[model samples]
Structures are given as C-alpha cells and as structure tokens.
Target: SAKHSDLCERRNIYADEKSSLESELDKNLVQRKNELEMTLIDARIMESETLVENESFDLELIDKRIASFRQLLEEKDAKIDELVKQQTDQKELLDKLRAAEDKQMDIINVEAKTSRKIAIKLETIEKKHNECLRKLSKMGTIPSDCDNNYHNMSLKDEYLELQKCKHKLSKMPSVNQKALDQLTEGREKGRILQLEKREIKAGYESIQRLIETLEHQKYEKIQVTYKSVSKFFVEIFQRLVPEGKAFIDMVYKDSADSGSAGSQASGSHASQESQSSGGISGAGLTPTFAQIDNFIGVRIRVAFTGKTVVKEMNQLSGGQKSIVALAFIFAIQRCDPPPFYLFDEVDQALDPFYRKALADLIKEMSRSSQFISTTFRPELLGSAQKFFGVKFAKRVMILENICVKLISDCNMN
Candidate 1:
C-alpha cells in the first residue's frame, strides 16, 4: 500500500515536469516562426530594391534577345522556303523520270514480243534439225547416242545467249563478204600453186641427176686423157731433161664413192635456188663441189731432177714454165690430133737448151700437125721448110723469100 502511494506521488511529479517541458517547446516553436516571418519580410524588401535598380537594363536585354530570336526565325523561314522549292523541283524530276521509264518499258515489251516470235521460229528450226539428225543416225551418217541432252536445252536461255552473241557480233567489225566470195578462186589458185611446186621439185631432181651424169662422164674422160697424156708427157720431158719426172694432178670436191645416178638425190633444191638467187651477203654460202680448191682443174707438177714438186705457175722459172707449157701443148695435140698450130715467138724466153728442145719437138709434132711459127731464133729458123721475111715500107710491108737452110748445114759443120 505504501509503495503504491509513493509511485503515485512520482508520477504526479513527472507529469508536472512534462507539462513544463511541453510549454517550453511551444514557446520555442512560436519564436522560430516569428524569426522566419521576419527573414521573409527582409528578403521581400531586398528583392523590391533590386527590381527597381536593374529594371531598365533587364528590359533592354529582353528586347535584344527577342530581336535576335526574330532574326533567327526569319533566316530559318528563308531556308525553309529554299528547301520547299528544291523539294518541288525534285518532285517534278521524279515524275519525268517515271514517264521516261514507262516509255522505255513499252519499247522493251515490243522487243520482247519480237524476240518471242523469233524464238518460236528458232524452236521450229531446232525441231527440224533434231528430226534430220535422227534420220541421219538411221542412215549411218553419224553415230547415234541415247543421251542427247542438248535437245532439251532451255529456249529462253539459248535465246538470251543468242541475243548476247548477236549484240557482241554487232559491236565487232562488219563481215568482209567480198573476201569470202573469193574463197573458191583462192582454193583453185592454191591447188595450181601446189601443182607447180611439185613440177618444180621434179624438174630440180631431174636436173640434179643430169648434172651428176655429166660430171661422171667428164671425170672419166679426164682420167682416161690424163693417163694417155702422162705417158707421152713423161717421155717428152725425159728427152728434154734427163732424170726428170712430171705429172698432172686432179682434185675432186666430193667423194669418189658418191651415190649412183639411179638413187634419189639427197641434195637440197633450196641450195640450188639460193645459188640462182646469187646473194652477195654470203647468206646461203655453203661449201659445194665448185667451191673446193682446184676442183675440175688440171694442175701440172714437175721436177727437173728428182721427185716432182707441185708448184703454181708463178713459182716456176720462166724457162721451166715455158717447157711445161710446150709439153702441155704437145700432149694436147697428141690427144686431139689438131690439123695445124700457129705459134708467135713461143721460144722467146726459153734457155738455149730448151729452145733446141722446143725446135725438135716442133719438128717431131710436125709429122702429125702443121706447125706455123713466127720466130727470131736461128735453130727454129733453120728448121723452117718455107721462109718469108717482112721488109717495112712507109705504109705497107713487103714480103720477101729468104734462104730456108743454114749455111753450115748446106756445106760442112
């Protein structure tokens, strides 16, 4: 009971403290509201003073901003008008483009119709061509195949391809029909040219054979004549120069075992043609039978005492050359047996011994051939059967007979 009474007393005390704190909080709240009202009143007074001081400047700035905004709006209006004009022009151009495209489409439709007609005709022709191929296969004109897929080709694709080919062909140069028309004539001319070439080839072969035969005959003839003449030549030279030997040498360009005349000639006709052309640039200058050293030439080799040395005519002594020349003349005469010979001072450069030998040779050869000599040598003059001397006149020569015999021969030596 006592604890309860004390608790009531503390509660009354706490209640009294709470009432005092609540009253103090209310008073503080009222003071804060009054201070806020005073601050609002002071701010309103400052704001009114600021508006009064800067009102003219603010109004001028607002007017300037309005003017700038109006200028920008006018510029934007001009730009909008230019854009609208461009848009109208573009609309008109689009309409014209659409009309031109429509016209082009109509022309394309017409061309497509024509192409379709052509395609129909080509299809008919292709059918006929296939039928003809079938017939040809049956007739054994061509081999038949079961899988001829080419016949099933799309007409549209083929027509498109043909159009492309035609376009390409049109872009190229025109056909030269005139040159094509001359094809038959050209073929005929070509045939004639071929025939002519064959004929020329045949003729060349014939000529080559003929030349071989002639060369062989000439070689044989020279060989036989050289043999006969060498016999006489050695005998004559021995009589002139004791212990002397002489002979004629023959050289051949080709081998002795050349092919027979019956064989086909392996020699080229091109070489013959080149020879006929006679190029000076040495372009076709290959070695031939004629180009060999001393080919078909008769060279005389002679030695007065020992084995014969083959020397050129320029290398021999004058008298020795003269003897050789005379020997050759005599040899030739013996072979052909000429009816007469007219010699002009043939012993002019001969040595005394050779001169006598020449005179003796003339006397010996005189039996077979008549020797007419014009000489200044006493030995040859004494050997003459008939003598005629020339006495010079002003404009003429007088012929007088001289004694044919030497004085020592007529009497005693």
Candidate 2:
C-alpha cells in the first residue's frame, strides 16, 4: 500500500507539474498569437495607407490632366472666336468689294457708250475731210487760166468805168434844187472848219511867243530890281571893309531876248575918301534899262591886299560886316522909322564907343517906335529901363523901375 501511495503521490505531482507547464505554454502561445495578430493588423494598416496614397496620387494626376485639357479647350475656344471674327470681317470686305465691282461696271458701261459716240464723230469728221479734199482738188484744177497783165487791164477798165459814172453823176442836175443847195452848204461848212483849225494853230503860236516875251520881261525886271538891292548892299559892304570896295554881281543862266548869253551886270560904289584916291571909281553914270541888260550876269570880285576873290557876302568877318550893316540900317531907319525894331546881339561886335553910339541911336529911334535889344556887356546896363537877372536855379528877378520883384521861383518864400 505504501508503494501504491507513493506512486499516486508522484503521479499527482507530475500531473500538477504537467498542468502548470501546459498553462504556461498555453499563455505564451496565446501571447505569441496576439502579437502575430497585431503584426498582421499593422501590415494591413500600412497596406491601406499605401493604397490611399496611390489613390490620392492618381487623383492628383487626373486633376493635372483635367487642367491641361481645360487649357487646350480654352485655346481652341480662342481660336474659334478669332476664326469667327475673321469670317465676319471677310464677309464685310466681300460686300464692299461687290459694291465697288458694281460701280466699276457702271463706269465701264458709260465709257463704252462714250467710245461709240466718239467713233461716230470720227466717221463724220472723216467724211467732212474727204469732202473738203475733193473741193480743194477741184479748186486746184482751175487756178492759172488768166494772165496777170489781162487781170490788171480788166481792173483798170472797171476803175475807169466807175470814174466815168461818177463824172456823169456830178454833171447831172439834181432832182430837187434844195438838195443841191444843201450839198453846197455842206462844202462851205467844211471850208469854214478848216479855216478855224488854221486860226487855232496861229493862236497857239502867238500864245507861245507871248509866254516867251513875258518870261524875258520878268527876267529883265528881276535884273533891274537886283541891281538896286545890290547897290545898297555894296554901300554896306564897303563900310565893313574900309580897305576894299564891294559890289554885287548878277549872273544869268540863259540867252536873253536880245540874243546875249552869259551876261553879267555889276554896280560898284566906294567911300568918298576911296574915290578921291582913284583907287576905286564908279562908271560915272547911271545905266539905262538897255545898258543894265549888258551887266545882268556880272560876278562880284572882292580885292583884299593883292588877292582878288569871288566870295559870298556871308564870308565877311562878323564884326566888320555888323558895323557896316548897322550903319546902313541906322541910315535907313533914320529915313523911315518902322513900327517896331528888334536888335539881336547887335552890340556883340561893337567897341565900347560904338556901343554907346548905338545905344544913343536906339534911344533916339525909340522916340518914334518901339526898340528892343539884348546885351551881355555891363556898359549896356545903364541904357536899359529895366534889368532882369536869370539864375541857374531857374529863378527870374526883375529889377525893373527899381521895384524888385521875383518873376519866377520854385520856393514861394
């Protein structure tokens, strides 16, 4: 029994051990199985992700292809639109071309009608030319039949016949005597007109002669008047230059009626003292109107020292001439007093003594007429009734009648 119990206990322990081993083995197998299942699940998940990535990639490729197709479609649509615009333009051009072709056809038709009319006109012109050529040919055949001498004789005979008929008509009596009388009166009127024309020509010649005579008379009068004025000038000139004599000379431009050309007239006068010395003398007689003509164009000659010259009166020295002119003017004024007299710078050339004399003369002349003079010399101040001082400041002071007054000034005070 003890052996049997030991055997049972060993069997029990073995069984228990077997059972525990089996359990451990089973748990390990279950864990390995679960791990294998998880590995399979991960592989499935990786495969599903790869499939999804491939689907997304395919979708992206399809989208790219769709975009490319859309672009191509847009290009095609643009090409179609361009083609449609070109077709519309081509239609419009074709319509204009048709209209132009129709207009050209109308022009061509009109040109054809014009060409036909021109052809008809050419035919008519050719017919007329042919007729003219035939007429010219006929004329050419009939030209040289009559001799020149015979033709001239025939013309002379006709002229003689006409003259004989005219003679007969002139010799025949008029049907009405009144008509003959009228013809005679007409001839008398023509004769009178001819006489009047001759009279008019004679009158024109007479008028021309009269004009020439009048011009000659005017020249003579001028010469005579100039001689008188020259005589007065000579007296003044001689007084100016005590050493020489002066005379005025007349010059003529053309021939006088007496047929003398380039003639000159001169009248000379000298002082009494100069004449007594025989250095200068007058011709001893006054010239008549006829003798004055001989001296009408004489030139004045002035001799100073040994030199003889012809010079204008204005060429004389101012002071010398002024004295002479003043003397002459005083003489004239003494003879006939003027209503008023003005002396401008008359004392400019006078010496003190002459100035005094001139002042006295002016005062004497003032009794008959008004005398005004301007002087800068202090000696002349005593002779003035009033004194006026002109200042550089544009002021004028009048000391006239010893009542000093300001004539003009900028400042009132």
Give the Cα lDDT of each candidate.
0.69, 0.62
Model 2, residue 140: displacement in angstroms? Answer: 42
TM-score of every model versus the real structure: 0.41, 0.33
- Where does candidate 1 stray beyond 4 Å? 1-194, 221-231, 251-296, 306-312, 392-396, 404-413
Ten residues in sequence with the least summed lDDT for candidate 1: 262-271
Instruction: Find the candidate with the highest lDDT and give its number.
Output: 1
| Predicted candidate 2 versus true structure: per-residue lDDT over 1-413, tens digit per residue | 99999999999999999999899879998889899999999999999999999999999999999999999999999999999999999999999999999999999999999999999999999999999888655433322544553465777786696588557757865545245546778999999999999999999999999987886787677655554555554554444444555543343333244332222232323323223432222343333455544554543444433244433345656654566567556544544458988777788987776666566656655677887766766445555555555435447554433322432221123
Candidate 1, 1-413: lDDT as tens digits: 99999999999999999999889878997788889999999999999989977997899999999999999999999999999999999999999999999999999999999999999999999999999787544433222342364357688876686578568757765664345436767999999999999999999999999988887676567556756675566667766766665655443434223532311132233223322333111123333434343355544556676555434455689888888888777777678788999999989988777777778778877887798888776777655678777789998999988774543354333
Candidate 1: RMSD to truth: 35.5
Error of 1 at 241 (Å): 2.5
Distance from true position, residue 199, model 2, in Å?
A: 5.0
What lDDT is obtained when candidate 2 is compared to the true structure?
A: 0.62
